[model samples]
Target: MMLELLSPLPASLNLGLVLLSALTSGLSAAAGIGGGTLLIMAMAQVMPATALIPVHGMVQLGSNGGRAAMTWRHLDRGLLAAFLPGVVLGALVAAWLLVRLPAGVLELCIAAFVLYSCWGPGWPQRLLGRGGTLLAGALTTFLSSLVGATGPLVAAFVKQHFAERLPRVATFAACMTLQHLTKAFVFGVAGFVFRDWFGLMLAMVAAGVVGTWLGLRLLHRLSDQRFDTLFKWMLTLLALRLIWLGVKRLGGA
Candidate 1:
């Protein structure tokens, strides 16, 4: 019974999930973005719809939680303090309201956000003071519930606020950790059975830690300009794919 509860997943798929977790964490660690989205997309290719969202949320919580611990010394406490209250409010609304956006609408919004992050005129740093921070938090967390992977959305905000690589990466991880934690709470309240996937989730998290360590080491060697270029290109391609997905969803409907 305990074994069954730990993981109903087949041995092969469990191995794949662990590997995917590590690779995606490595992506986040090196790029300071996109890993969570990639992980969810990769897993979505194989996971059942009923189990996918909660299970993906659990893995990301672990992945970002590990990164947050790794970079705690550099975390922006003021930013977090400003941002977190909105997260709480956002999560509460998601739990109570159950905002089920139309699939086409969500896909379009995500694509638009991704494009804006890459090419649009960004909001000024001065304008997004404490209030801006709170609104950013509220919107990102709210969208996270609907969109599956919002790392890039929050990353765009963090990048706008922090120009340096280390501080930017640290804060990004911390915010995502908080976001994933809140998501986990919403899932629990909604009665998703987390216990069933504990074994696989734990394995994936452990793998993520190793990947994060490797990626961080690589990050130090890469140039800031190079990383930024890579980040934008990757985001653009992902956004295009999202737009395509949205079109497909709209067509299907």
Candidate 2:
């Protein structure tokens, strides 16, 4: 079933989409942003709405999984351990709600929540304790499943905790991979077919690997302050985009 849809796409188009998705994924990874948001938006226009979440999840699972594997040595095991259960629980709840809920409203809510988390006040900074990490994991994972990706939100939380650059990026990727993996499994059980899209998925994965390698190389050259500044502005812009999307949906509704 999934294969039939993929088989119709021209080889060139498949390759092109994969390369494009990969570049974005790499940039997102380098900046500690999740790539799923962009992938979902792009795929949403072309694929059935029902399939977009699962497909995006599978592709991101591959992309983030690769990034996590490459940077495994730098992962913060303590943080990962603390956050995993919350993320899993969030993903499960999100999966159950995916089909029944209004996705537009969900996305809007996610966008608003992320905006608050990123720029609301000094509260987030002050609240940056053990409890915050667990809450961030659960909330971000749940919202991520609903909206496709909220990398900037997760990145913001990570930056608040980890002062170092490399460990922060690696740790965020690991956490995101876990989230994406959970999303993929949930969507699979919900009846999103993957076998049919295997070829397309593979191409996207290959491109993502190359892009991640390039991004990692670039990461090594960036200064801590520079990365921090870049991340702040990028997240601000992402917040605005989400807000705009929400407004658009509201107007349409």
Candidate 3:
């Protein structure tokens, strides 16, 4: 029965991913970042190249949607409002250009930016404002459309504006939900057959919701100081991974 429900993928792998969904979702909920990036990295190891980005986006959509709904009250409305328009514009631009950036180069640039954001001075207040949010939404969405995991970049940018954990997590979830939604739509238009993978996606999402609930509980127990320190280090490690992947890719090229 379970095998039929998640066809094509081996039963063991399917079950493992469902569990990974829960685990990564919990990681994001408690830590304020890294879940989506980690999930994509894992999926890339097993999923088909053509289906990887779109499938990953759909799974993330479900995970972030659940997170956003759970903490809706804490979301920063003004920033979200400004950021959303950029998401739409970025999607349009990416679809129009149909450009595929060299994965290695893009990864390296993103890693650099993420490292700077994590350890360097905060962006000026003006840059974290409406105009900046709009630009960020567009750029991150564009990059996500190409690369599939911009969670670290988005999280690094979002962290600059909010100090508290709940608002940051909530707002970041909301932002990612839209970004992944747009990516799904773009890939759908480009003719990816989503239905074939729907069953697996649904199962993964269900697992993620359970994980999110547990993660939020953990989040509540964490001190602000601890959360900040953990969040930065988590991003730093993820960034380092990106740098490694980028270098490996470039070397191969």
Which has the greatest lDDT?
3
What TM-score goes with each of the models?
Answer: 0.81, 0.77, 0.81
Please give, for residues 1-253, the per-residue lDDT of candidate 3 as tens digits.
Answer: 6755684678888888889999999989988887776687667557765577788889999999999999999999989999999999999987765445454665676567657656776445567878899998998898787667778778877888888889999999999999999977788777778988888899999999999999999997755667567766876787787788778888885
Candidate 1: residue pairs that collide: none
- lDDT string, candidate 1, 131-156, tens digits: 98998888788777665677877887
Query: What is the number of backbone collisions in each predicted candidate, taken in the order shown?
Result: 0, 3, 0
| Clash pairs (backbone) in predicted model 2 | 2-196, 3-196, 34-151
Instruction: Name the regions of candidate 2 deviating beyond 4 angstroms.
Output: 1-13, 103-123, 222-253
lDDT preference between candidates 1 and 2, better one: 1
Per-residue CA lDDT of model 2 for 73-97, tens digit only, reads 9898988888887797888888787
Candidate 1 Cα outliers beyond 4 Å, as residue runs: 1-10, 99-127, 223-253
- What is the TM-score of candidate 1? 0.81
**CA-lDDT, candidates in order:** 0.78, 0.70, 0.82
Locate the minimum summed-lDDT window of 10 residues in model 1.
1-10
